[model samples]
Target: MIDHRRPVGPRTLAARAKAAVTLSASLRAAVSAGEVRRVVCLAPDPHARFAAVELGADFFVDTVLANGYGLCSYVFGWNPARQTVNAPAVDQFLGGYGDLVLRPDLATLAPLEPGVWQVVCDVEWPDGRPVPEAPRTALRERLADAEQLGLVPSVGIEQEATFTGADGAPLVPAGLDYSVAGLTPLRALLGDVHAAVDGLGLGAESARGEVHPGQYEIVLRHRDAVAACDDAMLLQAAVRRAAAARGVRAGYLAAEASGMGSSCHVHLSLSDPEGVPLTAGATPGEPSALFGHFIAGILRAAPDLTGIWAPTWNSYVRLRTAPFSPRSLRWGRDDRTAAVRLAGSGRSLRLEARFAGADAHPHLVVAALVGAGIAGVRERLPLPDEARVVGELARTPWEALTLLDSKPARAVLGDPVIDHQLAMLGEELTAGLDTVTAWQRARGDLRA
Candidate 1:
């Protein structure tokens, strides 16, 4: 039951159309000037990056065709290993070999190679329908649902990653945990990253040293849910490019073999159409009924949504009992140990979701979070009492798979979308099971 009394915010349909048109014109001008030699288009998956390259001259005319019809199987051919999979017929029907439209948002375009400009694209079907399996589409659907409720959702993402120098050595050999000494060694790399992200128009709030050696975290200012996720993805890409330019590497892997894990923390809030906060109450440190219900929804849906938040096999490695990552389905005020932490007051009141790892897809994570919150509001779910400890979350990918296919996920994400996710994740799980890890080999050779 949406509150029909209020109107949609600035992100109305007409406004978006105008913005898109303006962006298209700008891209065409850049192409005509030969400022862009190669146009790199991309879309992201839960565990991989999908992309295609086009010559600049071809891009001008092809832009219309690509936006309307779509590129070839490039969107579907990519797998986690950076190799193409021989997708089944059913998969092909869904998205494996079909045309995928590339909508060029000027905001996401950034320089990569000397003459190459990369633009992050949203994948859609040939007829302009959003691909259900696409991460960006998932987030957009959830945002639309929130809008229908007369509420606007905003998100700020904090992502951490490890940095290695040209010699493949850790920038910091020991944990400093936010110490200035830890940041001093990596100033050059961090500086480059800041400049790159700023050039792309991603307003980076701050960059700081994290708990692990050779690790750093960058905070992006809050924005609408979809833009926030897009900024997060673009920020990650920018950091990587910046590091490479400085003769280093930036890894977003959840956990290294012998180092602290990296995480992608999401801070979410809801506001009314008039930009008034709906999350906080008049009293200090107290949340409104709407905020409480949203938290309740997230707790109930946490188990089922774990697969999206922690999508990879290595992702489970970071969900341990300690290390600042939440292992349980709990919520508390300013509590880092809980999966959801309440923070701020009045208009700034927001929920911090700490379950996601750096390796997870930003769009999918945002979708699961927002969708679950919407479900909570619809059901008028009750928030649990604040607690220091609670029941554990899904600990393994197999367990996450079971929870993802459960009734709760279907209730929120619909059958087709959940089914597609299950199929894709199932493939990754099966492949993982077939591989022999180093630990297995070492143990088996000595004992078995």
Candidate 2:
């Protein structure tokens, strides 16, 4: 349901100048050629403002306005090679202040780079990392790994995200009929999403309503992993922007509220130099050894991969057997209850990982999946029995993650990468807990 009413047409050089003239004349000239109205600046974090200022961004708003109008875009960045860290021991300092400390000082803001830049509307994450480890980066790394194996991995991303009401509330309790106009806000966002996807060359597939109310899904055609992930991120951002324009918020938080959940589904494939599907074996309908190895690797590493799929505590709530949710790590032929399912057994035999929630970092999830596959092939690890019953699968995400964090899993995943991912996830879990304002503190028990 892409919103048909976008910012009308593209903004003219003069209109863009009018928007920029208040802040800086130079920025007005830099974007004189009818650029899209996607980027915006914010105050409070003057550091963010200063970096944007340096990057020639002229439009400025506060964090509140940015969140409300969804205008925040782009993060001022500092490359590790080019910029010096402001704090030598920033990690240690942050670790002491919160349950899981983030590396804020690791972010160095200097100037914008030349590569394709999206209007991320404030490039910093909640913890202030300049270059965040997003799904985009994770997919890029996995593609690199695939190249080393003489295989190039390409993928298409189909994301399911929810939307909030005008008053910022869940619309699920009302009813879920994908065709309802109540979802006009989310629908409106899809138009901008389409524009974003087309610009990025990710090959837009389709945008439509889902079974759940206020829940929408966008599917894009397969391309290079990095390009696909980049398009996905922009789609996510654009959805938020479009929803904002309609006085609604596009929710990406796997579980945005109590029960509504979002998902990130990936369609992956590996090809040879000639662009023929390498995983597509000798017989058209028969599964290739590569496909088996990859699927087996993912299954073997499911427990450890929990951190990539269910990154947040709340995300686990959506994993148990319920409406459109998976509860176990079993793989089956088109079984939605299993964490991984083999859809096509032929040359197109590919496993769909159902565990990843919208909140899961795309980069980490893809990397873990691909890495596990490579490990399986390299080590000749035996594939486990296909899961026949959901009851046999782990009940909680932690159960799987704990298994993944075991000595054997760590050995296969490499200690350093596992440690870093776990540490980062631990930090996110800590941050999720710090939202104390959502609850009530009763000083005394109510004895009526």
Candidate 3:
């Protein structure tokens, strides 16, 4: 496998400058042609979304400067809430007073409105080094590790979300599921969403009505790990923008009191440098050693990785045994109830991870998967018996936090990443603990 002679590392800053020059020319031409007026620069944060807008002319100049050098410190200062700056994060950002260079090839620049275009950028330190806490950087590091083992990963993501009307209620009443009548009401909206996603060069494989009322699932084709995660993020943005244009809202919360849960399922496969699938064995329906090792790694790390995959407080509510969400750490052939489902055979074999919620960060999720799988390979871990079914995964946020704080998680995901995530999520958990909910009020007010 691994071609030891091949080079590692991303495009240099010089190369990015050249690409930015070419892009600037195109942007100027589009502006002069009256095809664009405004440019939106976007960077996805842990929980909140960050964006900066500028006139087309101003954006062209800034783009060139950013690519040639870097963008300012405000980009990485804020926490997930966008309210306060995490002091440690600020220290990492050159003491909250420096710039961050954009990664050379990790950006999606496309038209979002008639006279405006949006650019999704992945970033690094000004010196062209990976930012330890950055999700994209985490995934990139894991991918590099896979490359060392001669393994290339392809990831396919399936995202399910619900639509709500202007009143913040389900767009349609309950009980439609996958019926034609259920889908007919939202056909126009779905068409626009698909069109917008396709226009941005994000491959949207298919979209369909889901089992829940006002819920829908969109499947994206497989791509190299980083690209797939990027596409997934963009897809979510596209859906929300498209829905807003139609006077509705698109929500990806894991669980809603009256509606079913939404999820983000990841399908992964390993291939060689030449693109030959490595998951299948000589015998039909059997798995190769590489596949077994990868699966073993995922199973071993599933508990520790749960917090990242199901980050929100509502995420645990979606992990019950009913309605197809997995409750156990088990693998099964064509079994939707299992955490890991084996689909296809031979060249088409892949593992589908059913644990992630739609609310999880795409980059973090991919990083965890790739990191764990690589760990499995490096350790030469053995696969568990196919017939064995493990008990339920962490069913609550506290359980997930305990697992995440363990040594195994730190070993799998470097200490920097684990520490940063724990700090961020720990804040959310603390805030939640201080609040009293309506459910508590209803159940304990008079009795207590």
Model 2 CA lDDT for position 66: 35
Off by over 4 Å in 2: 1-139, 171-201, 257-259, 281-285, 345-347, 382-404, 408-413, 431-448
What is the model-wide C-alpha lDDT for candidate 2?
0.51
Q: State in Å the error of residue 444, model 2.
A: 9.5
lDDT of 1: 0.73
Measured over all alpha carbons after superposition, the RMSD of each candidate to the real structure, in angstroms, is 5.1, 10.9, 5.4
Best by TM-score: 1
Off by over 4 Å in 1: 1-16, 28-38, 48-50, 55-58, 61-69, 84-90, 93-96, 106-117, 165-169, 388-391, 445-448
Mind giving the per-residue lDDT tens digits that candidate 3 earns over 154-222? 888888888988777777767455578777778899888888877666556777787777888887777
RMSD of 2: 10.9
Give candidate 3 misplaced runs (Cα > 4 Å).
1-39, 48-80, 85-99, 104-107, 444-448
Q: What is the TM-score of each candidate against the true structure?
A: 0.88, 0.66, 0.86
The TM-score between candidate 2 and the true structure equals: 0.66
Worst 10 residues of 2 by lDDT: 101-110
Ranking of candidates on lDDT, top first:
1, 3, 2
Residues 319-347, candidate 1, lDDT per residue (tens digit)? 85338887788898998877899988777
Error of 2 at 151 (Å): 2.4
Model 2 lDDT tens row, 1-448: 1111112111222332244334233223344542322332221111101222212232322222233222122211112122222322233323323221111110111111232122222233345443222333344455556567766566666677777677767654444444666556544456665554454443456777776666777776655554445446656655566567667677776676556667877666666644567565677544467776777777767665666677666677666533566655566767666667666655465667776778766655666777777776666665556774323334565575565567755654455445545554454445556645433344233332
